[model samples]
Target: MQRSYSPSVRRRRLSAQLRRYREQRKLTAAKAGAALGWPQQKISKIESGEQKRLPAAELDKLLDLYEVSGEVEREALHECARLAKERGWWSKYKSAFPGGLPDFEAEASAIRTYEAQVVPGLLQTPDYAAEVFRAYRLLPEGEIAKLVEARMARQGILNKVDPPDFVAVIDEAALLRKVGSAEVMRTQLRHLKHMASRHNVDLHVLPFAAGAHAATSGSFTLMEFPDPLDASLAYVDTPTSTLYLEEEEEVREFASMMSRTQSDALSPIRSLSLIDKIIESSIEE
Candidate 1:
């Protein structure tokens, strides 16, 4: 079964709710912190969704102080507290390799990914993904295989009854990286070409000449959902932790960044042509 709460998403939701209650009561962070016997910075972090957990007793006290006495409100806050303490499947793999942000990414009904450095994980082949995992140099053979299988499992969502639309924007450099070997790259490029033809998949390429674009800040994925009121999410993966941006302003900024990147990227047909050219080059090698 798919999990419901991602750490980042949970943090944002809890933070937003806390801020809302505090604002309704006209409580400043300093005042609230003083009342709760906590540091103002701690209150700020919780309000901003940067903190992961709050002590259960502290949370109960904050809710009571905020006058959030409704049964529904109390239940929601308790649920957040519960999620904060729960561990995810990825945690087990964290000791071997940094876990992916698949929990939130999977929840998206539409995914827009920009890869300036490498192939996006969802579209990668098993061989190519193996090579990418090897670069980490921290995972054992069994662990690497398990991780790759987990990644591959994520692809099943694309084939579901109502699959999410996927738009991938890749840079010219990613195609030229020659990830595995000549043969492996050739096969991976062929796989991408096939995926590009899917009705739900839109693949585009940012040519080498289209330099200094908005996405130079590295790779990111903007995920949209079917729920009209549910805010879209932006995902950024780092070596240690994955960040999820759910606030309206942050989501809008990432959306604009995607628009700029897609505007300069080649169309799906042209992207296929470029992939074909890369495949031919790999063959000649």
Candidate 2:
């Protein structure tokens, strides 16, 4: 493929492949480490993607130990390892979220998001984003501006020629909530409608009538890559920390929540109608 896939994703996929091969070979981490003359922690980190980069020599050794077959498979792994070392545009924003959301988002084939209290970062307008940053009052003025800029940059994925299918299930509470002044919200809502017009953007609204639900209490994102070798990821952001769930069992739980949330949300047409109603209201306008 001509596309420049995110290096981080390749690294992750590579790590997963190695882990699978080790298990298939019936080799414990301890046995693998003993054979490779390395510490078990080293193999553990490599398999878990905690290692920043997988050196070529180490990868060769692991493949040989696993008795990996065929030149094509070997070359593919090497290629993935090579791509894994490169950085995406978001590399410069490491200060905001080091090796975080952007790394995964850069090459995602599908992005499923659910928001409760505010607009998803991908859809927030600049002024609206700034107001959101100011809400916490944790960062300095300069930091707020930087974060807004970083957030705006993140939205660029929606504009890509082969952009991920962006699906957002937003609670009605978020639409009614006042983040910034009327003008800022008006612009934000209008932007949402505009984005919804696009082919790849799928927007839905979960109404208050849906009653209390488990998923709506917080927010999360589920990202899926094009390659089946790459497992789905679940992202959760909190006041103090962020979590990236890579394990299939854990990601499945979030995936189930997203499925339930989608079922309760208003359909695309009805979602637009609700948005229009909100826009027509005195507060948002």
Candidate 3:
């Protein structure tokens, strides 16, 4: 079966391609908009992926304006435009995850995550995830259940035939913090060890002894794509809002931070050993 591309990823890929083409032609957004007889705002929106439903005729015109004549390149970009207009599986829970990070995550070639407070969402068990939502948000039971279900569904990506390379560095404090109960935490810790064993997933733990290191502020996920034109995206999920950064410099800084944090963390072998110790402790408690 052919793989389906997420609209979020498609949009971003198309946006970056369009912007690069214009830049190569030595045209600013305003100049490009003027040449195409379009408003500057439309150019900005299209380049930002905010205008998801870009007409093919307009895309063709933009290509013509940018002198993109090669058939192969044109067809690839045409496919991107087509995919951007289509919704992905996560669109069903659009309200709960309005930021579209999940869709980007679904299509990533690699995912680098750093967490200082809690277990990464992709590694969370259902019970542990439920407790996280319950403690952090004041939503009704029905809403919480829906969110939890959506979160679990996100994990399906890990089981794909070609799963992304997953690397996560977690704080020891997150391991010790009790989410639901001792039983819940015990299960969660065991699950972490199991996930760490996966060939594609690399798990590390930052011990408290390695204090005041990189990424001490909070957690963020850095997503990479197979297509170089797609660039990299850094996702920071805060209590109030979710922020996605696409700037080259900002994304580079996050990538650097991941390297630093990983250096400060325990290796996979030792991390699993620490997790086993935590599981035993949780069981005794």
Candidate 4:
């Protein structure tokens, strides 16, 4: 059977649809809440993916209020309900995952990521990943194991028969950072070298010489889906909360920025050489 989705995943889909419906009808959250006899805060919570569940009756009423039509739209809402109630494998490790970061990562079909500090999670080796997790210091041992396993499981997507295309633009600073021992760093770099050879993976490195780039603001990920009907998503991770941007114009802007950054970065072949040099230097030290 297909794996069930987590509640947060369901919430995100519902929230996006609800926001689109409201915008199409030119209704603000306050105005919609007023019409439904619900608090504005509740409406906002639902839209932000903070509210885990909603009453079926309330959802139906809201759909009617928004004047949503057609069987497809109606079926979308029903799917949201089913996904919301379904239990995902990750649900068992709720104590480890904060918010819905893992869920979002899992659902993404094509991930375009730019990292300024450290290697992206999907490319991390088990030892390097453990060190990174140790930095968090929020979860117990069992929970940490579960979290690590979930992260490793996500890598399976890269090896699937029809793997998602991955385009990563990593900063030179990231390669220079010694997260673990020199040995661990060497292994990780070698692993990256291997991944770069994969047809579905494209690795680029933004050299220090490429100063003052578009991604100087921070790291972000743009995820695209197979279905043309689904909107592309842009994710910005912060210390406290993660921002998920789905607005067509905003996502387009991020895509443009990423393209510019990638153009400035070294090609896959040169990126591997750079990483190798960094690893050798670290080993020499």
How much is 96 displaced in model 1, in angstroms?
Answer: 6.2
lDDT of 3 at 245: 94
The segments of candidate 1 whose C-alpha lies over 4 angstroms from its true place after superposition are: 1-4, 36-42, 48-51, 54-58, 95-100, 135-147, 153-164, 197-200, 209-212, 224-253
Candidate 4, residues 1-285, lDDT tens digits: the string is 354354655677788788888889999999999998999998899888678777788788889988987778887787786688766666666654555555655555789999999888889888888777877776676666766787777677687666778999999998888887888888888899999999999999999999999989889999886545456889897878778898989999999999999999999989988988887787778
Q: Where does model 3 exceed 4 Å of error?
A: none
Better candidate by lDDT, 1 or 4: 4
Off by over 4 Å in 2: 1-4, 283-285
| Alpha-carbon deviation at 179 in model 4, angstroms | 2.3
User: Weakest 10 consecutive residues, lDDT, candidate 4?
Assistant: 1-10
Count of residue pairs whose backbone atoms collide, per candidate: 0, 0, 0, 0
Better of 1 and 2 by TM-score: 2
Which candidate has the top score in lDDT?
3
- Assess candidate 3 and give its lDDT: 0.90
Error at 212, model 1, angstroms? 5.0
In candidate 4, residue 49 scores what lDDT?
69
Residue pairs with backbone overlap in model 4: none
Evaluated with TM-score, which candidate comes out highest?
A: 3
lDDT of 2 by residue, 1-285 (tens): 245468778889999999999999999999999999999999999988889798888899999999997799999999999889987777777777753788889889999999998999999999999999899777898998998899998899888889999999999989888888888888899999999999999999999999977595589999999899988999999877888888889999999999999998899999999998888894633
Residue 148 miss distance in model 1 (angstroms): 3.1
